[model samples]
Target: MADYYLAPDGSDSNAGSSSAPFASLQTLLSALEAGDTGYVRGGTYDESGFADGSDQHGTASAPIRLEAVDGADVVFDFGSGDTGGLRLWKCSHWEVRGFTVRNAPSYGVYVFGDSTDVTVENVTVEYSGGDPGTSGAGFHVRVSANTVLRDCVSRYNYDPSSGGGNADGFAVSQATDTVVEDCVAYGNSDDGFDLWESTGQRLSGCVAHSNGWDLDGNPAGDGNGFKLGGGDVPSGGHLVTRCVAYQNRRRGIHYNTAEVAMEVYNCTAWDNPTNFYFTAGEHVLRNNISSQGTVNIQDPVDDAWNSWTLDVGDPDFASTDPSSSKFLHLTTGSAAVDAGTDVGLDFDGDAPDLGAFETDGGQDVTSNVNPVLKAATPTGDGDLAFTAGTLHYYDGSRWVAPPVSYYDGSQYLTVSEGVQTDAGLVDGFERGDLTPYAGDLGSFNVSTDRAAEGSNALKTAGGRSAWADIRSTEKAIPHGSTFQARVYFTDAADSAILRFGVADQDNWLGAGYNSNESGIQLSESVDGSWTELGTAQMTPVTGEWMTFRVEWGVDDPDQIRIRCFDADGVELGTGTTTTSANQGNTGYGFEYTFQYGGTGPVYFDDLRIV
Candidate 1:
């Protein structure tokens, strides 16, 4: 067993001791033997990358450990276009903790190719990918087994290429028995947690929000909060529980076209395109809450006691605002409180709350005296009990106060002298018996008649002369800026109008496909008056499906572009319109309307809002 030291001001030729440390972590890692420990002092190391191949693998009994020095902040700034930061390839039995990786052009911490028993804790990866960068994901694990990431944060990772489609906060591909707990992913350009072709994975006590967009408010990527599965084959029977996803650009918890069954429990989703879009898999969803969003469930064996199934209106959350400290917690008199079936998980009430946080006498509070003196005190691990008078807190053992505040990227905020807010556990369950198809306030029907791609399509009741509308409420377009919506429509009516409407804007942006004339027109309405911007000639045949696309504010912020394509993807017509100052430019919500001159129905399919 040996101990090594690394510091920014040290030299590699000196002895790797505390007094004379090495200059780089790569030098120290190369010199480490089994049962060796390396301590990196507080400083920024501007390096390209660090990797340990299979030849440097450590034994289980004598693992290699690398950690930041106590009471120090170690940062690795891999500036622009580096392949990776802190890479462990085909190695085993390694422990890494307490470090920050910033400005990585690609992945921050990459463990790939048969690495086993690798544990990472209290690490923060931020600003991972940007312009002039390639596709990257923070904390990427591929084909690695027995990997654990605890109390980590992946934030603000973006990939400018592919419109920020490939960058994710945490991506695990074909990793077996990987566990991610007490982690947070925010402001990522793609999905928060993407499990692509990954099996034997478990995600718990994780928070993912504000993904699928960049900091500048540009909408891009799939924007799913938790994308459970994807790839050529259906590759997941993953366990996801006690997770919270909100304000994501797309689905809060998306199955992502996986055919495998996923077990999701005690999760909360809000302010997303669709809270739970489990259309492609046999998912089991229970005790989950879809507050302020839509739910689309296709095939599920066990779906019961969910907020949508129970019809428990609003969950009466403690606070709907994410800026509040008590966001998404079940409050007093909430219908979701104690409305769950015991699924062998811990709870505060007679039963578990419908969502993530259980309100045990309000976990967040400030008191003058000791909270233990109160009749109902906090017992959860992350329960906050701060005494203003004594400036002390219960660290799950005793009351002690630290000198200064320190965030080591762990479950709790630590301070000097190793004082923690509470026990190590941080922000801290089954799916059930029901039919395949479900319904919500939108009253959308799954029809097997005509579909653009899938086996089923959404159908609405026919309207005589008035417009029948289907609006996805709470599905706000990111920044209300540029986006593209595509839908396929077909009907027997000779004269019909299919239009996509912005949520609250009174003006009609344009008609998606108007068969009244032999042309397609993009128009804007001001003061109930319509003005055409551009038009293209095309005559459509009745009873044939055609694709309609609307590109809103794409090139110009106040512009609307429309395109029509035949079933074979050949362009039929195109139109462009730029809105004036009188017309609203920014719109978050959206809807679609269908109107036929005859008393009949128009079928729509494969609706995609991106």
Candidate 2:
């Protein structure tokens, strides 16, 4: 029943108190007793020679609790190479949160050897693994059960020496009753999320994208977005619901090569070359959408209500831009709206909408049109009136009138604005600060040295070792939206490579330089995976600027259009991209990223989103 503190400035000799905290995690773990809570202050911790969790053990009732202080950014940097940042071997009942582990020679966090009831939440693991022809992963759990990994992100982990054979964002093997929810895995050289030789594991509300490519933009791994089962043994009876997989080099949601019984529901797979690839298995797939690729399912039993079978045309989603919160909204005219079979799942319309989300039909509400009232007896509060032509409902206290006009048999009438205005300005960098932008992990500022139109422009710079991005705070692009921007860069050699696009809920869409830096690359980030659309050659002059524009649609993968221009507005290139069927909502913000390592400064100005 004691509390301990670990800070970078404190020492082991002092009592582990708030003011006199232990300087090292090793020292604090040695003093931790069952039911003891350890608070780690904001700082960079270097655990080089320490054996992770070797001396730390807690009971089932009173697990060892290690957490970062509120609003603290705790980072564990394992310089160059190390076995692991935090290792839990043969340990049980431990809880860890709010800590980032990076640059480990092997795994960022490894839980192995019969560990159970271990919870890892709000933890980020990246930049781990350097063993050539060996294995490494951002987070690896093996022979463990009853593990919960929630709200965690794993990215940019690779083993280049092995040519990207064994490195994944998050991997679990031989584990049962494991639940991974609200998790994201992207940008790893290997698979984004993988489960091998595991059964009774459930993955919900998770995303796996842009795997199989190293940070340097080179393909060197297995590259599946979500690999369900592997190994010689059959790993069966897994459940995956409300998950998304896109832009991976291989199959999006793969059953691997093993025969397994699995169930997939309400999952979305888009832009994956092989979207849904399954081996010989007894699988149940319902209410799922695969926008592209050859869906290979062997002996599937409850397969129904998929986007591939519907001949009603495109599902007309709201927005594919991941930057917006509602990227996957179903539009009013979407073929998927109310088209799914009832599987005892609650829905908004007459029936369930196929895919991960159900569109509420609220976005289609127009001004002045009266909704038709249904004739039904009121059984609960706020129930709609069922009487024909009735626009009022009886409340417990009183009758409530509807806000809009009731539907007249002749024509639907509503108010309309006399005129429409031009699209609003998203950003121009005139504020002289990046206060309107948020950084995922990188450095950015307003620069006066270069501008495409004004005296100031947004400048971003980051190391080539990782991904860095700055995104606009406002979501300005809606369904059927168009936007453009002016970008400036010195040259291809500057290593200040940049990618401009829109991101939402772990997915992205945009174009940038290829990892090889030889040509321009058009890509879409589905979930967290990057899918290459097409490539073109357009060399940039040193110290010159270019203009780029895009038009997006709510339905059809072929409706995404992008165009590039020189400083003089000369058309350089134009192309169309494969559209994602399950695009969620509106476009939130304009994003700029220094993808991979190419140090230097990149500038942007005159951004507009409509």
Candidate 3:
């Protein structure tokens, strides 16, 4: 095992030592035998058309490695080069890491001719194959086997002469056993990850966005986020899990004429022309989610518990803003949360979430199994239990199926000191009285205009002073509990802030629809100063009722999660934040405050602790 060095300043005739390094990479690469390591020093190397070590071979126990120096910015600039920038032809057991390759007329890094056991990590490839009518890619692996690519990025590699059709971020053709993990491909001319006639490919935690477009914003290539297959051979057997594809020009995850079965689990596709275009393969899809795009799937595909197959609506994403980091993550109370069948994947809740990112915040799942449907009746006592998704009890003679209890707008609302009703412990403003509230009662009233459930709702006066709020009477809300309510804004043009949350004399923790920002906000106040925790973009439309759910201590004793739903029960946005406000303290109840001035009133109804 020996060490060699390459630098931009040294001469090629110099000894490949640390003091007198070789000038070009070819000198170091061609001289490295088995168990040799080459260090590329920081600086730009303008070498082109060098292929002396293209067919080098290394042993399994003593593989060769070429890596950038620690904390060095090593760059290979193939300026107007008419060949592949870095070619590893028929190389075996080679590892390359921490380097940048750009401005090549062909592929930035090409590993072909049966290269096996090659690993590439932390490498960035951009601006490859920009010449006229030339097809190129950032990373191309053809006829390669056992290749691993991790933490790599490929972007802005376009072939305009081919109408952006031939340039891809990462193209693996006729390859077997390829693992691409934690890679990002964006702003490319063609598909992000193109696998043609490839088998046994596993892509996990990869993100592909803004692909299939040229630098001039012209539509180019197929525009697929992940084109899993394309060739005459029906090669498949691919596994794509926890991957995100968004904002592509065409399809997000496509099965391009591949006949073999592929497994796509817990992937998310959003903002594409077509989310999942699985028309050819007999794919196995589970715990996947697609939003804001058309789903075009054919028969023979084994799919279940997906967002498209379920009768329920969208998965209630935490944030739809693609620019935000949490684009497709699930939120609290989402239909996608814990709604998936176990598919041999680890999850964070009762079951797997139907998306790329789990929302239970790392909660351990003890057991996740679909309920069995018992066709035979109970023969003895205590044999009756949950059978076929319903509770059946033996009444000493026969099995009696009881009504499944669901949320019917009644639970956990109680007051230990004040009046109570069958409706709830907190006032629903149904009695046309204000007995359950103690502060600022004159600024609110029961109106008959609109309500979420019943006919009447509480309406706040139009002109209340800034910071004036009404507090409900003390109710028994335990720490780490969650509350839900429905709120309607009568005037969209108003700039007033309709704030609703829980509060005590010293601490205030809540969320509200702030019209001034045209968004929803989660905030906390200790003493008298208020601090915003998180905010999401939302447009307040007139007469649009929204549901807000605030959960205290969801992940920890000081953590809070907030979710806001639109009129159609679709989640608009969500936020999470930690609070220094007191938990499990007395005199804590719901509080609705009018902050700032507006001309129209806001309505609140259907308050429940759920």
Best by TM-score: 2
Q: Give the TM-score of each candidate.
A: 0.63, 0.64, 0.59
What tens digits encode model 3's per-residue C-alpha lDDT throughout 65-137?
A: 9999764667787864566478888899998987788777777888889899999987888778855634678
lDDT of 2 by residue, 569-598 (tens): 787666566666324444333344334433
Model 1 misses residue 182 by how many Å? 0.6
Question: Mind giving the per-residue lDDT tens digits that candidate 1 earns over 1-610?
Answer: 9999999999999889999999976788888777999999987788775444345677889988888886466888776444656788877899988888877777788888889999998788876775355556888999899999987888778777667898899999988999998788877889899999987699988888889986444787889999998897657798998888898998899887766787898899988889998876567888899987898887554678889998887988877645334667767788888888887667876877787766655552321111222233455886755432224578789986533322222112444343334322111000010011111214345456655543555555444343333332222232223333334444433333333343223444555555444467665555556566667776654456676667765677676677777767788777776665333322222223334443334445544454
| Position 49, candidate 3: lDDT | 62
Q: Model 2 residue 109 lDDT?
A: 82
Cα shift from native, residue 487, model 2 (Å): 13
Between prediction 2 and prediction 3, which has the larger lDDT? Answer: 3
Q: In model 3, which runs have C-alpha deviations exceeding 4 angstroms?
A: 50-52, 131-134, 361-610
Q: After superposition, how far is residue 359 of candidate 1 from its true place, in Å?
A: 2.6
